[model samples]
Target: MLRQSSRFVVNRASAALVGRGRRFSTDLPAETGGDSKFVDDWKKVIPNLEPPKTPSAYMKPRPQTPSTIPSKLTVNLVLPYDSALSAKEVDMVIVPASTGQMGVLPGHVATIAELKPGVLSVHEGNDVTKYFLSGGFAFVHANSITDIVAIEATPLDQIDIASVQKGLTEFQQKLNSASTDLEKAQAQIGVDVHSALNAALTG
Candidate 1:
């Protein structure tokens, strides 16, 4: 009886789905998307040894060529759902690093920085675009490529100040009324982010 009842329910549900013309495969998750991971496995860590002397032309320190290509800083800024920036040449990037605010330019040191919730200023020549990021990681490569994977990024103008204020107030209340340590911490984080957004907008 139990087996038959279960089979009948499953059959009815499947029939309803089929009748509605909705075919779904259980193999894949409903909202699957591409990852924004930066892989650097192709980078060579070993230094190449200098070759033997090749007399006058090859061995001699070559004169600087006027036609030489200039080095450019390529910035790839990505969000969870899609890429915000891709291999774009930028003059400077001001990141809100966990340690402190840091500026990156061409030939900047190859290092990783943990970003915080703040504005990321990207400069291209005279124009500067500021993006408010929630949090993420910034990986600077030796070849003048910086990859930024942010949890959430948006411009201050797109974010409604009223909504941020409401969230901040609610989180503050949650923090105050929280009885457990974990709840208070979570609420505190919300309050902090909302506070940061408010500051970014007001300032």
Candidate 2:
């Protein structure tokens, strides 16, 4: 009975030892089939990873500036049966056409027109002057050259006041001495012509 009791106690002790050994072996690398130490080392070395890339320079667009205005103008003046007058490019050139008065400026479109009896005012830098035209035609070109072909163009300073007055008196006398309707009408036209000439001279 004592020997049997001892044998049973020994067997129980052996079984407990074997179970502890199996639990310890299951935690080994070959039993777990993975390296826990290596995984831990990798976590310590790189907690989180990101892809690598090169940095670039930043650029911005620039603003634009405005342009400026022009200063000078050059043009030619031509007349029929007279010397052409050379002038600087100016603001305006007024002409008396048969239809009416015409005003021209730089960059004006090309045109051809007839002129009447009136004053032509030319405006330049700080100066304005007038020329009297009896009848004419004007041709404007791209370069602002105005060719004025005139039947008559008289400068105010060059007109003779005495001659105009004398002509007026003669035409008045002819109107007063007319003996027929036809003669009266002819004399009346002469009077009108002389009167207009006198007014132009005086003006």
Candidate 3:
């Protein structure tokens, strides 16, 4: 009776172990040859991967826009007093007008304007620089060209501050002793010219 009861217990334990093994096999991944459908259906249920981040479109540098009206005429830039500026572009001229600074580019309307004594800022493409002119009249044509007839054009780099100051002092003395309207006008022009030169130098 005792041997029969021990045999029955052993058979029940063996059946339990087989059932656990079957359960474990069903829980394994498909790659391991288990009956798991999870791997096959995973891609359909999961969300798509996102693209990598990129720089904002607004942050990119833009190319320069082409001018609508192109100039056909060739410019001739002349600075009688400064030899260094003779090599600069002849067109797209900037001249100091009597009233203010005037900018001339190609396709500009034809006009003649008086110039004041001041610094003329010239721009060729993105690069810009300045030249000092005492007095001049700028003539612009419809052909997109300009001619600056200047009394004197001085490069700022070539100006001697001490010499300019001396000229200013002498002109001031002449202003004080002016005996005629013409002399006063000449003195005033000299003072204005020197003042413009000093401003360009200091700037």
Q: Quick one: best lDDT, which candidate?
A: 1
RMSD of 2: 43.9
lDDT of 1 by residue, 1-203 (tens): 45554464465457657845532121122232111010111112212322222122222222222243336678989998989999899898999899878999877766889998998999998988999999899987655678899989997679999999999999999999999999999999999899989988898
Listed per model in order, the count of residue pairs whose N, CA or C atoms clash below 3 Å is: 0, 6, 6
Error of 1 at 180 (Å): 0.9
lDDT of each: 0.73, 0.58, 0.59
By lDDT, the better pick of 1 and 3 is: 1
For residues 39-139, write the lDDT of model 3, one tens digit per residue. 33333333252222222212322212225666333354555654334334544566677666667776666677888887766677676666677666766
RMSD of each: 20.4, 43.9, 31.8
Worst 10 residues of 3 by lDDT: 49-58
Ranking by lDDT: 1, 3, 2
User: At residue 170, what lDDT does model 1 achieve?
Assistant: 99
**Which residue runs of candidate 3 sit more than 4 Å off their true CA positions?**
1-68, 71-74, 78-92, 180-182
Give the CA lDDT, 0 to 100, for residue 200 in model 2: 65
Reference-based lDDT, residue 154, model 1: 96
Locate the minimum summed-lDDT window of 10 residues in model 2.
Answer: 54-63
